[model samples]
Target: MANFNDSNVLSSTFYLTGIPGYEAAHCWISIPFCLLYLIGIVGNSTILHIIRTDSSLHEPMYYFLAMLSLTDMGMSLSTLPTVLRIFWFDANEMTFDACVTQMFFIHSLSLMESAVLLAMAFDRYVAICNPLRYATILTSRRIIHIGLVLLCRSTVLLPPLLIHLLWYPFCDSHKLSHSFCLQQDMIRLACADTTFNRMYGLALVIFLWGVDSLGIIMSYIFILRAMLSIASREERLKALNTCASHICAVLILYVPMIGLSMIHRFAKHSPPLVHILMANIYLLVPPVLNPIIYSVKTKQIRRRILQLLAPQRCFSTFK
Candidate 1:
């Protein structure tokens, strides 16, 4: 076991791992992964295109949806090159800088996604709880400001996380558990004490994800309270329906995220396949599912998609 005193750690080559015992099935595994990438990329790209072209989706809600789509696409593309390299071509070697760069983008985009979801929850809150002031509360300028703030928040805090890891000397076993780099996986290879890194990472997760999750929950609580105050049951139902897509989007992201975190923290002795599958699901499921969810639930988006697919039928059905 190499320790902190290892002088060659900075130049060490890190290799990504595929499924532990299924080396021969790597090609088969790539098939599902490839399909997922295809669906995620095309699905998110289509959402972005529709949102851009359709005038009806120019509201604050769809604007936030567009941000979600872009973040999903970024997450997908961030993992694509290395994932495919490992599973398809058996090429998994990465230089120190390359691994750090991938780690930065993956984690940053994830934080951005959390922030976007939080913003979307607020949008729903305003639209449902204060319908009259929705426009004023979430103006275009304010939305842009929120976007800028999210961008900065997601990107700014990541450098210290990655920079700290750079100073730690790695052990002889520079093998990463997943197809892509993660700070958790990277720190495990460090020869020095990683207590600080682990604690700092936990602090980040608590601060970023924990706070965003609480904000989302609080928004929904207010939304529910305002919803119940409606005199008519039908009105309450109608209001609840508007949030279904966002609720689904939230679950799609945070569920797998929590699962992966648990596996990393608690399930140390579990099968390697568990970690790989959970990690992939955490990254891929939301990007693929969010677009489908919104397209199905948002009548405007659905109508636009139907129009693109079958114009006459779309008019007849919607009319």
Candidate 2:
């Protein structure tokens, strides 16, 4: 064990924990993880393909959805190697730089997803609340600009946290709580003061997620108000229905995120399994479910998916 007192103890290797106390069941745990990865990759890829192939989906809403899928796929790919290594080959050791890189991609992609969701909420709000100005407000150039802004935001905000981390000398217990590197998990292994890291991380979360969440809520408030002004109940319901998929996607991402945050903040003494499970859910569930939710809730995407899946039947019916 490297001495915690020694400030010069810069550990080069970090061990990723699979499922604590379930070393014997690592193989079994990997089964579900593999399935989740498969579903996430295929589902998000299908959503992207559908959006690309259909000209009708060339609008701002589908463009944002495509961005969301790309973010999900990036997050999944970031963790896939380490996760499989730990579970399949029992290889848990990660080099310091490699771990930091993985942490960067995972968290950055997460922030990107949050931004995409916020943009989707704004898209719906404009469509329902200010239909006349929707096209002008969310032009293709503006959407592209939004995408670039989101990418820059996600990429730029994380390096300070990581660069500070690179200087911290890790203690003997360099074992990360999850199969992938997390800034929160990585900080706990440091021998030096992680106060800056923790505080800055919290601030980033609050700034990005908190502000995004507030924006989403405000958008929905306006949307509901707009819906109420419509004289026809059917029109109101129709307008509200358009938001269902985005709402589900938001919940899928935020609920697990909030749960994981609570677990890390307040339930530090919780079982390792609890932390691991919550982390997995936080990372994996959104990617797998978002595509399904959109396919089921959005008629255009659903019909496109169905037509893709059953071309002959769709063709026959159309004929």
Query: For residues 98-169, what per-residue lDDT tens digits would candidate 2 score against the true structure?
Result: 988999999999999999999999999999988999999999999999999999998898899999986788
lDDT of 1 at 292: 87
lDDT of every predicted structure (CA atoms): 0.91, 0.91
User: Candidate 2: RMSD over Cα atoms?
Assistant: 1.9
lDDT of 1 by residue, 207-313 (tens): 99999999999999999999989999999999999999999999999999999988888999998899999998999899889998998998888888889889998
Query: In candidate 2, which residue ranges exceed 4 Å CA deviation?
Result: 1-10
| CA lDDT for candidate 2 | 0.91
What ranges in model 1 sit over 4 Å off?
1-11, 315-319
| TM-score for candidate 2, residues paired by index | 0.96
Residue pairs with colliding backbones in model 2 are: none
Model 1 weakest lDDT span, ten residues long: 1-10
